[model samples]
Target chain A: MNKKNNLLQCPNPQTECKECPIRKMALFRDVPEDDLGWMQEFRNSQYLLPAREILFRQGETAHTLYTLFDGWLIIFKILDNGKRQILRFLLPGDFFGFQVNSIGPTGGYLHSSLALMDSTLCAFPTTQLRLMMEKQPQLAIRLAEMEMHDMNLCQHHLIGTGRKNAQERIAFLLLELFHRVRLQKQNDYDESSNSIIFPLTQEDIGDAVGLTSAHVNRTLREMEKKGWTQCQGKYLTIRNEEALSKTGQFDPRIIISKPLI
Target chain B: MNKKNNLLQCPNPQTECKECPIRKMALFRDVPEDDLGWMQEFRNSQYLLPAREILFRQGETAHTLYTLFDGWLIIFKILDNGKRQILRFLLPGDFFGFQVNSIGPTGGYLHSSLALMDSTLCAFPTTQLRLMMEKQPQLAIRLAEMEMHDMNLCQHHLIGTGRKNAQERIAFLLLELFHRVRLQKQNDYDESSNSIIFPLTQEDIGDAVGLTSAHVNRTLREMEKKGWTQCQGKYLTIRNEEALSKTGQFDPRIIISKPLI
Candidate 1:
């Protein structure tokens, strides 16, 4: 059970650990029930954020870690000239803002993360996490595995961003999100929906894929004409998965399901 | 202390763990001497690889992890069309080939590694490392930190690959390697040496930067004409670090000196 926070206009101040909605997909799913119970005490609050709200800013001193219990988020960096690069997308059950100040007493985030849609996150104090990790080596292992999994995903994104053309890149991104959503939902995912629910704008796709928004729009239109997919607004329906896969030269094998703890 | 293995034609089979050339720069530098001593047993074998030798191949089963004792190595992935992309470079004191098989029983190397020069490596069986990790939880933390450091590097590389121009990309990479070499060899590095020893060919640079050899050549020549640096066979001297940094928009802060473990 969660207590509603009246002052902050937060939906819940505390969320029951075992009954959490994303418990099945969360990082601690593999963690033992006893260990998970320990985390229940550490999760002090849950914050509900509106779309475009920055969860953390680049160069901001990171003092907490958050679990994205629901909704979409993107971690990005802005250059001195004001150009932005989307580093990685954070899905439900993902961890964010865990940059530990290991080298010195003060450290800041290398990238900024903003909520792509209305989102809920369970916040944990970094100090408590470090203490819990020291007490439970297995917890530390899970955290390490999470970072490894993140690294693997970033490497895969590198291939698409560096080598693939605009069309292939967009196709690859769509397919990746599709598979990720499928994994999170499993058989419960509604096939009748026909299209994947994506909250990202074309500019978001362009930023993520390292292409200009104009180029992304042109590529999506070309794919639409080819009958491979229908990309309208925030929804994409893959009419021909085979063609998209072939065009992107995408291999799902590169994606690590989970990191080995 | 370690015993010399007579059967293997190794240069040094029994290097005292404390006196290890990379002991100071190695990941385990933070580890207590007693805990660090445990690694002496794993340093049972050493392999010297000549340039162009493939240490491991993509899709091949990964059985061991190696620590580079000397010389250079590059981890790369080759596309279906045989176009290669350099994933990361391995230097002295760097760990290589720690592939976590989380999905299923059969797991392969995500990328292939080739020796860029005659390199000496101390090899350790992955199984033993895993077992050691179980016994020494701290070792697992260090390993995870290494992977995070790697991911940060890849993300920075991604920015260059996706957003930067050909000349900027080349400048950025040179600055990166120069800094890395400087970090690895702090005071012992000879002041008499004017240029950084770069064993990479222009083609190698091209693969690393997501460019063609011709493009890399043109970029290098352009930088040369501007009196930026002199690029000779296997050597690159930064004649003007300030100009190169400005052109590349290089920030050493992006690099993780050591990941927050």
Candidate 2:
């Protein structure tokens, strides 16, 4: 008898996780009965960090895979001149820090990940996680699919940096965040909404979009003036999602999805 | 027996393709026998054109997947301000033009791709491809994987736009292109005294790296002066691949791959 709650036991410090509340998460949902029980044994809760709190830093060895239970996190990269680019917004049920040795040695660093909002997640050892992947091709395939989606988001950022003006770039980022976060759980947007609680600062947005902080500020003001979005510090609301997307030049169909692991 | 040469079926009026030397590259390489025969029936060559030829106009329905067989192609996006941003370079045997159904209708005019050098390819119809994908999970999975790689390249472009300096960006792109092209076949550099015969115009390279043609020209001269590369018109012969990579701030491990399809 494998219940969602069955006295989780593991040696790792983050092994306290068992009965997570996030329902939309597709990871491990399709695991067979016996494997699900086995997975529950390897789970744990490492720590909960609030917005701007660092979970890991660049050049740090990744020791565990994190499955977000709640809250938001931003993964990003920083330049030598101290500029930073927010890569993506990680939400509940999103898994990070996982690797597949079958591919090659994992090299990319966790450049920027701080809580965008207070967040919780289950952490599992990378080696053990690999065992699960090797045992379950579906899991490995799912991870690859997730990476594909992450890549699509980055592709859009390339457009923003290489071409779109600051205003258009910022508008697109907000719209993307809103739509992505909405899927984890209904917060403020539908399939497409510009209104979502994004944790990135204007400076962060500027860096990702290849603009200055002052430019980001000016763009936000302009967007508000145009009635495309309502910005209140870190909190934002989109007045017209359609109009907002045009600003970012984002393609909605790029959200190619596969069966979640 | 399955072969990769069946990409030469006649379709469009541009059917002056029968005698083309690079007849439908070896795409069905290692494809299972059953799948190869089916793919052959859908292959079309008349739909293809020489380098700089429009495969499909921007915003045009992404009706076919173009697989490079004999030359190089540039995948790029045009901005509202009429500036064209070269996203990345696609090589022979590479696949692009995969679109998710729900994403915006990207057909006929949003972005345009032209051959950087005279090239050949096989085009697969969108309708037949989709139907085949629905039936072949592996093909869909392979397409998704390619999309992931293309997206990674996009992330690299974003870095070029947002983080790296102009020199670093140029160096990075050079090292990347060298590694990619070399992996498949030796470029001009290898065939003649370790000099790469990079045949891209400064304007094209500028569009790719988000630099003005003048700036790109200046940068090329600077690289020549620094002994980092030898650029005489469109022919670039890398002085030292390893030393050049150092200038690009590249960790060869990042560019390392096992020839994924």
Candidate 3:
């Protein structure tokens, strides 16, 4: 009945592990080349998801782990009353779907991941990854470090979600996302651009900050009117980052850049 | 000189690997005996923290990770405006101090930990643990799974903090703490009691639920009046878990009982 393609299974041939884009990020920067090759071999394929497509469902079996190769996704949970909370947003090089496979059938997927835009995810079979981890222990250590980093980030976000006001929540989310994107962009070590493509919708922002879409619109407009940021179409630029950071109490350095292992 | 014995270092020789109280918990249930022995040898000592003492501070360099040997502790972040959000309430055998060593000196600890009651913590040097993990790869894998599980729990808590109403928040927190305590008590494999010794102060409860201490007091009194729960001294018993869970949408099975790795 539906003519448009909602999801596409992309044919992905194994590429040179050394040239993988996410290798330069903190998640994989320190991985040895041999282990990286194992990862490349372990990867099943890449899948393309259209905007608004459900990458994984809350009550379904999730046996695959995904790496964000491109575009944006939001990991969210819907409550009994139909209220939603965005747990974390995925950017290029970020890893997700780890939780689903980590916690199996009892809960199925802890949270459902939805693509915010057309996204490409490199899928890896959990069983193969586990086997590979057994052969190469450092890979497991690296993955643990990555998990610790993710845990820390989520705890930090809880501060904004649990205690901060609406204005502060929006500010914190913006500054945090900007920093994460900037960090990912540093794969090429580029530092010239201070702008990023804002892929989030107002509704998405509302779910993230625990506010209504109307509240998000009002707060964002206020931020723009104050000259703290500029939002033109898809691009969001921090015009007065100092003031913005002060308002949000956001310091990116607080997010650990160094790997734990 | 103020000699109040702020930190009392308790002498702890390595215990038998098979006798660890927390070994039965999901975090370390699967770890081999040799790896457990390595953990025992790596522990520096256990420290006794008095009630209301700070275990760690924000912005302080952290070189150790802690295991809750006894009593209770709360991991929290204080906002710029002085509001506090309780990140997690650590039970006996829960891991705390994992962040300090993870992030190191770049930004130090992003949050502060406080003793909710007089507590004993088994401290392990992060560097030594890292060394041991390198030799025993499976240990690293297990630790990663532990971190993943913690991250998942925090993400779930965000739903109550960010979206749930005051009543729902209180209900969710109570049900969750009860479940965690029940699970921790399962170390003995005993299915005897439904009551738990709740060591949290009203302010601590408020911080966890994003409400004022006064509001928390009122909510507790209301719940008591409703016959859904009973609070006597420090012991809390779920009188009507079915009703309470329905109100909070609390589901314990959703928390992964099995380790990932």
Candidate 4:
């Protein structure tokens, strides 16, 4: 089933090569055939390494735009004192490293993005990507919209940083990620209850929510004591889903639905 | 020569009729003849209002969209507790009521767009507006972009509200208004550095910045003392523009340049 040696089979089962693999990874449905060919050419790319393996360091020239086929990636920035503050996490179908369009790296560096697991990604060459985008403007438009979407996600996450307390923000984040991962795993998982199964490390979750690792532990324990939620390693059981959302003042619509405008 | 009654003449003495009486507005240049005819009809058919007249209330359903010809307009929103927040102040060539294809009202209501002086505006019936837009899809697309731009402005303003401390935010706002007014006045002002004229109350400035009037006064005084900017009534002077921007951590590139996606 596997034509390439380094990469895994593209999660698509019982399908003809004509039907091909990526029917779901968001932009796959939107990107046209020739562009898709370019994406596939980009896919025969280098092997994606494990967590903490840096994609490209901040201040380094951004050379590749990743089409995330599998697993999790975190975008972060390193402060002057060399402490890392994680800014955001991308899901299965999301792309990253798009501040590449600017004239220069004005925001110092993009810190570093690392795969939380051994994820497979299609890496498009920046120059080719631009040319292909010019040839196919819809992809470019979608890319712009997607970038705007991520910026909105960051703004939403900033509420956790500025407005909400540590506990509330964590709940809100878990719920938000649950919806995204749910969309991906919908065909595979049971839809009756808590079918979404993206397990996140407490450390990573803390980073995404802008809290200290210790604070993450303390907040989870507090929520568990209150029977708001149950945590077992990376796995969480939503004891009272509605109550959890309320604590976060979480509007599912913000993360789930497209902007009405 | 004044055309039909109710339509205001461009204050500038040198303009011929075919040149649209004023050269500053870009809306009519590329538009089709039919659309222009519709617009001219809308202009002649609409009513005129005197200076400082309230056009509509905040949350009021805007059945009419106003195409400004002459005089200034104030767009402000009244909050839940009846506090007014100024979203923007517009000169000639601005339009209000984004409810063209949209059924009924949108989220933010149409506020009382008062004329700072005796003003003329063209009003199109919503049904006719839809017909006009269907014929000119490009204009519709431009409208989308304009709406998006305004939304971007609002998002940045929200960023100021959520992220910035009062002083930096206020300074940033003053600089922005000065820059915009300067651009607007370059068309008509032959004399007076005080061409940044719009008699907007200090209270209006406070509303936009989410500050109390007293707080706005204090911030303005501090700005004056530091020589970052100056304000005398509606007249504003930007002495050190670069430093004011730095105070807000403002990246003008994001504001000025279109994203090359």
Candidate that scores best on TM-score? 3
TM-score of each: 0.91, 0.76, 0.92, 0.61
iRMS, candidate 3, in Å: value is 2.1
Enumerate clash totals for all models, in the order shown: 0, 30, 0, 1
- Please give, as one word, the docking class of candidate 2: acceptable
- Backbone collision tally, model 3: 0
Model 3: residues with Cα > 4 Å off, grouped in runs: A1-5, A11-14, A26-30, A100-107, A187-190, B1-5, B11-18, B26-31, B34-39, B100-107, B187-192
lDDT of each: 0.74, 0.61, 0.75, 0.57
Tens digit per residue, CA lDDT, model 1, A100-156: 211212476777777888888888776676667667766666767777777667776
Error of 3 at A170 (Å): 0.8
- lDDT tens readout by residue for model 3, A88-128: 88887777676533344463676778888898877777567
Off by over 4 Å in 4: A1-25, A32-35, A38-49, A53-60, A76-88, A99-118, A128-137, A140-170, A192-222, A230-232, A257-261, B1-166, B169-224, B231-236
lDDT of 4: 0.57
- lDDT (Cα, 0-100) at B151 in candidate 4: 36
Model 4 has a DockQ score of 0.09
Model 2: residues >4 Å from true position, as ranges? Answer: A1-47, A98-112, A127-141, A187-195, A225-228, A239-243, A250-261, B1-48, B100-111, B122-148, B186-193, B240-247, B258-261
Tens digit of lDDT per residue, candidate 4, span A87-155?
667776676655521122353233466666677665656556556554554554445445445544554
lDDT of 2 by residue, A1-261 (tens): 111221123335543223444533546654565566677777654456656667766665566677777788777666666667666667877777533211223543436467767777677766575566556645545554566556556666777776666777787888777666666555533655445676777777776678888888888888888888887776778797788887677656554354321
Alpha carbon deviation, residue B212, candidate 4 (Å): 7.5
Winner of 1 and 3 under DockQ: 3
